[model samples]
Target: MDEKQIIEAVKEAKEKSKKRGFNQSLEIGINLKDVKLEGADKINTSIKLPNGRGRDIEVGVFAEGDLNMKAKKYSKHVLNKEEIEEYAKDRRKMKKFAGECYGLIAQPDLMSIIGKKWGIILGPRNKMPQIMPPNKDVKEYIKDLKNTVRVKSKKNPTIHVPVGTEDMEDQKLAENIQAVYTGIERTIPVEKIANIYCKTTMGPAVKIKW
Candidate 1:
């Protein structure tokens, strides 16, 4: 789908979103084409958001470079493998972080080895590995990557996100939301379900004409 199609769909989705009971919604722009799956048969996962999710995200970064150094200066969750696991060891906090953190990022090597343990808790919640280039600037990337609006379904088979705001001059929110939606779309299979919708957090549905 092109930009117009995504925008219109998000407009249409706003009303449906209201019936579900949300004060506001955000977009999670992910590259749908980039998501690769391990299994072909089953797709069992939950999209768990943070409590009072209406607030903007702090965006935690986990990298092996200066990003780690920067991340540590900001928050305790910003740490190496051993530290993260230790922090996650606290049953309640682990359950909360594992439940609500938007995404878990790492250098590719670390991801390949330790993704399994983290995946055990985060995978089912649509928070999976977004393995990044090892030397990428961790803090800066986290700012853009994490401050997204979510366009997800309510524990159903299909989800929607606000691709663009009807009132905004630019479509940054729309694009970001679609990217995240696209990533999630790739995570599932075409055979399972067909499409994802985008709409406003408070607006009604507008059909995206092809």
Candidate 2:
């Protein structure tokens, strides 16, 4: 798709949307053709928008020892080993916690327990915690995740993702949409994309013509 077309569609989408009390997130829906949501064909990955998500993204971290203390500075919810098991037993609490957190991170040591206990809940939602890389600062991963958005296709060929908020510049939102499009294109051919539409949280959709 042409970059100019994306920016134009974004501008039109915002113009059509009603102003809301809170900042509305800008979203794009990419409808694909002949793509199967199975095995390697499935779409499940993260893309870091060049322009960060306009709103604050709260990440829930699962860590212990020094990492746990370090995570405290970046995330509000840092679960230790015991706390990990605690939240696992209560389905209600785990669900609420998952809903509140935009992303999740975990220490490598806790993967086993987390997978055994919480995988069922977090797996399908794509909220499973990203394991922290060894010898790396937890802040780097958490910060990047805050600006990233997950694009997944479930039970449909259409992939929906939030590119940015309405408050962001049109050019920035367009670049984000392009980033997501490029990411999907890496898996599915561009010719396989049926249509691409851009819209705000409560706005009417505007189709992008290239």
Off by over 4 Å in 1: 1-23, 26-55, 63-65, 72-76, 108-113, 147-157, 164-167, 170-198
Please give, for residues 41-116, the per-residue lDDT of candidate 2 as tens digits: 7887788888888888899999999999999998888899999899998999899889999989898889999999
* Model 2 worst lDDT run, 10 consecutive residues: 35-44
| Clash tally, candidates in order | 21, 0
For lDDT, the strongest prediction is 2
**In candidate 1, what are the lDDT values of residues 44-153, reduced to their tens digit?**
33233212234445454555666678777644456566666675566566557655555566666667544555656666666765676656666655654554444443
Name the regions of candidate 2 deviating beyond 4 angstroms.
none
What pairs collide in candidate 2?
A: none
Model 1 Cα RMSD, 1 decimal: 7.4
TM-score of each: 0.53, 0.93
